[model samples]
Target: MSSIKYLSAILILVGLSTCGAKNLQEQNTLQQTAVQLTDKTTPVVNKNTATPKEEEEEAIALPPKAPLPSKKDSTTAETFNHSRWDRILQKHVSNSGEVNYDALRNDPSELNIYIDALTHNTPTDAWTKEAILAYWINAYNALTIDLILKNYPVKSIKGIKNPWDQKLWQFGDTWQDLNTIEHKILRPMKEPRIHFAIVCASISCPKLQNKAFTASTLEIQLTQATKEFLNDPTKNELTKDAVQLSRIFKWFKKDFEITGSLIQFLNQYTDFEISESAKANYKDYNWNLNN
Candidate 1:
């Protein structure tokens, strides 16, 4: 009887141990299932992906289609008046190239009139290349100022959404934006000097000239603009053997290089000669508003 009782006790202990092991196995399986379900339901985000704003900017940065002259437009060379733009620039822009947005915003009638005139008077085949270039350059700068006025109190131009991409002006039947004016229209003209003449309302950009660019004065204006920009110590640190240039040179190096090497191009405007093997470094561009 004693032996049977002892055997019964041992079997009971074995049964309890087996039950506990089975429970632990089931618990582990349940935990694994929970983890798998979470993995399937949870969304994963890749940190390297571009945000919506960046994607939009990338799309806008692409070269736009060049505007063609209207078939109905006359071929007779026509000149667009720039006196209105001249007045606006003179009144608002200071000697240092800073703009007085506060004052301009108060009286925008002149700006409105000029923009309207530009909208109606698109360049035609008859327009001289100089006239067209001048028109677009003035149009670009004026429109940029208008954009700033429309969204006044902004710290920087980039703070505004789609500043370059907004189709705020019309040239003939085609709608245009700042990008179209600079990239498709001006850049294809192969006059790299346009880079200096067209200001993006940034600190490092060529100082906004007080006078408007005109067809008759376009050549002088471009030359002067280039020289002034290169000589501006703030924009370019020039030396005989080494030079630190504005970011514009790096961004538009190809534009400047079309006719010759960058060093050669700089020689045309730089006061001192830069060595052919001179080390070149670019200054960080300040995107702050020119105001």
Candidate 2:
């Protein structure tokens, strides 16, 4: 009977121990399931505690744009008026032949008019034609002088390139070459005096006249210019043995020779007798830009 009691006690103890282990295992599983549920419910955020996805969406919603002009702003006019230009021409002619450095530099509006007249407008009648051509040439020279004045202290006219290019010599509003202006406009009219009238701002260039050239006196003006330039000691000096002449005569020998020999051409305006020997010594041109 004692053996039976001992066996029963052992069996009871084993059962209790097994039940406790099962309970502990169930509690561990419950704790693991609770941790997994908490992990699924939690929200992820940046270190700054703000939603990174929301910040990115806000940045995408707004973008920068260019600023627009004010409603009251005005547009610029491209083409200048002719009547306004005519008034400027009047002022320009009044001060012709004389070098008005200040006026030329200070007044770009008037200067632009002069440039327009030269580059765009054409003289209709014979009288107006001569006047306009003379005006344009004078204006070109005057503007060149004005340009030099602005950049004064420079060694040469080549220092300023805007108007000096051979390509820029065009008719009003039309793109034309200097040769075109010379042959088409000036030559057809038989204005040979232009050879001596238009100054190119070179040491050997014709003297810049003090008075503006007008149609009424174009012929006489050109003639007198040729005569005066040939007679001026600074321009040309002739002696029995030798002659020192403006390098222009040497450079444009073909142009002068077309009408007559260079000596013959000179004789038309100068009283000084030049020998064939003098013509042979025709010196090379000094191309230094005349400021």
Which predicted model would earn the best TM-score? 1
Each model's lDDT: 0.90, 0.61
* Model 1 lDDT per residue over 1-291, tens place: 999999999999999999999999999999999999998894544547968876677779789988976644646456899998998888999987999999999999999999999999888777888988999999999999999988998988999998999997776788899998999999999999999999999998899998999999899999999999998988999898899999999888999999889999999887678899999999988889998
- Runs of candidate 2 with Cα error greater than 4 angstroms are 1-103, 124-136, 146-153, 161-163, 166-170, 176-192, 276-280, 283-291
Please write out the lDDT profile of model 2 over residues 7-115, one tens digit for every residue.
9999999999999999999999999999999889955546576678777866677776667644333232122223443354455433223333455557766656556
Off by over 4 Å in 1: 1-76
**Candidate 1: how large is its RMSD?**
22.9
| Model 2: pairs clashing at backbone N, Cα or C within 3 Å | 97-210, 97-211, 119-171, 119-172, 120-172, 120-173
